[model samples]
Target: MNRIIFAAAALAASAAIAYAQDPIVGNWKTELGDTAAIAACGSGYCITLKSGKHAGEQIGNFNGKDGSYEGKITDPDAKKTYDGSLTVSGNALKMKGCVLKVVCESQTWPRL
Candidate 1:
């Protein structure tokens, strides 16, 4: 019985660690230089602008794995949305977006 209890405890601990967010899965600055917090939302993730021009606006549905994700990011000031991609490495996060395949911009946001 003790062995079974230990095994169950180990399994639970491992599962908790697995579901925990990666380093980049927390607060960050956006391309517009605004601060936002990213959190799990419906099998993916959603980022809510914490400050600057887009405060309180949430960008949702970034689906990916292994530090790369893609979704739609909206600019609250301009009220425009673009196809956005995010790549995270260590303490740096690179975000890029294309505007209708005509123009694109990228920015590297350092962890906060």
Candidate 2:
């Protein structure tokens, strides 16, 4: 019984270690006034962007899951910045932009 218990404990510990080493612990690829924003977390994610000519003129909503977040994002093309709000789940992150507009979109991506 003691040997079985030790094996179980070892397996649990290994699983815990693997969870601790997750890579999607931060915000990623965010664009302002455009279509197609990118972000990954743990093993879950979400993405969005405005479509068409009004792309950069609209702000997208962050419907993030899991537990990730956005502290800040800069748009090189627009030469502007957006304060980020993020939600993360496993390997997914839902995002919302601080700027105001009418764009709501989400998608999951590989953890980066």
Candidate 3:
């Protein structure tokens, strides 16, 4: 009986972990053509560059849910940080960043 109870507990834990992962939690090719890994981080989501000049750098934090997020992102190419928003759907993520509500750039990233 104890072994069966433990098995059930373990299964439940594994299911919870799987459910915790958001749909956006995966590796993707960035707009700048770099590779990035996106996953849950510290009560939000984190974007990390895996390849390119900014390899292994955390680009920014995204706070949102249901395929939409707003946060800050670093543009490695330009070496700038700006307020950013991301929308993910069907293996594609649309990322937009604005500099002080003025200059804004958008890019579409596909899952890798």
Task: Provide the clash count, candidate 2.
Answer: 20
Judging by lDDT, tell me the better candidate of 1 and 2.
1
lDDT of 2 by residue, 7-84 (tens): 999999999986764343443333332345443433443333435444443233233343655454444447575666
Please count the clashing residue pairs in each candidate, in the order shown. 0, 20, 0
Residue pairs that clash (backbone atoms under 3 angstroms), model 1: none
What CA RMSD would you report for each candidate?
3.5, 9.9, 1.9
The local distance difference test score of each candidate is 0.81, 0.48, 0.90
Model 3 pairs in collision: none
N/CA/C clash count, model 3: 0
All candidates: TM-score: 0.76, 0.36, 0.85
List, residue by residue over 1-112, the lDDT tens digit for candidate 3. Answer: 9999999999999999998878778999976678999989999999999999899999989999989999999877677899999998989999999988799989899999
Which numbered prediction scores highest in lDDT against the true structure? 3
Report the Cα lDDT for candidate 1: 0.81
Error of 2 at 81 (Å): 0.7
Worst 10 residues of 3 by lDDT: 72-81
Which regions of candidate 2 deviate over 4 angstroms?
A: 1-18, 26-66, 100-112
Q: Alpha carbon lDDT of residue 108, candidate 2? A: 45
